[model samples]
Target: MASLEQPILISFKLCPFVQRSVITLLHKKIDFTIEYINLRKKPDWFLEISPLGKVPLLRVKEHVLFESAVINEYLDETHGERMLPEDPLARAEHRAWIEFSTSLFNAQHQLTQARREETYYKIEEDLTKKLAPLERKIGDQGFFEGDSFSLVDSAFAPFLMRSQIVADNIGVDPVSDYKKISKWRKNLLSLPEVQKSVVKDFEDLYMEGIYERGGYLADQ
Candidate 1:
């Protein structure tokens, strides 16, 4: 086994994308340091190094890497047990699903930020429409591809975590009707790596963000 290189992950406390990287690192059991920064007040050094001015930038030795997906693929390729499949076609399918997970994340953001019942329900309907395919695709196995967890699970876990938190806080479950998603969520939440992927005050911070946005759910 190649020795793992310790990396510093530059992150924001509540970023879901950053959470994905954190979960991947923790799942791989890699040694890493996390540095939180205010996105509103990014330092000159961070701005100089990050081309896209995004969180979840990985600094390994002297090399700085950006983009959560790219960083994750690099990490899986270089260290720990392989999270991606070995077959070329299977690997490509997993990559596509990983990309699809971003749409779920975006839909969740829209749903959370919606201030009106009409908008909220509309986004919810759209989200359900989006999830229908996934509900059909997901099988009896616990994780995305099967019994084993993969990069796809890491990519989608943050959205599931946040959705549950929002549902708990607002008393509305967006994913209640999706049986497969509900089951997959339970499985993901049971993992130690997924449970420990976020900051201690994650729920508090998430609710704070929702309240700050003045959404309908926040009022409820």
Candidate 2:
């Protein structure tokens, strides 16, 4: 077993990217401390650790790291959890899917806010069109990588959960319509570690953004 010090994670309670780091640590059963931050108003210590000024920065002993995917890999490597496979081709494929999911999210889902039902539906339509390919890709595979959960699963889970919330808020069920993808999402969320790690306040985040977009903003 690789030795690990108690890592410190600088994160935001509502960021899906930061949530990915939390999930991986939980999956590996690694003990760590969490320092929640406000991205708009970052803390002095957080900025000192990550000058780039981003949340989800992981500090292991004297070393610091950034980016959600990179943080997950660092956690796996340091803790010897092997969340990612050693096979080069398999690892590449996993990375591909993770990047693909992030790209799709950027294209269609990132800007969703409560405007009109039609506005949310437009996002749903874009996501639905993009998801057809993923649904076919899974085609009943229990996980993204063959039969076992891997790094790709960790990277993808946060986005799927966020998407589910988006669908719920919009009153349109993307996962429900996409059979294979829906099953995959269910399996990912069902992991005990995933449940423990993913932030629970995502719906409120959505609601806050939506309300703000609607010209109604409070201390949320």
The most accurate candidate by lDDT is 1
> How do the residues 109-134 of candidate 1 rate in per-residue lDDT, one tens digit apiece?
98778989999888888888988888
Tens-digit per-residue lDDT, 36-119, candidate 2 = 777888767677878678777887778888988888887888785587778898778777887787866564344454245655
TM-scores of the candidates are 0.95, 0.83
> Model 2: clashing residue pairs?
none
Q: What's the TM for model 2?
A: 0.83
The C-alpha stretches of model 1 lying farther than 4 A from their native spots are 1-5
Cα error of candidate 2 at position 85, Å:
2.3
- Clash count (model 2, backbone only): 0
Taking the candidates one at a time, how many backbone clashes does each contain?
0, 0
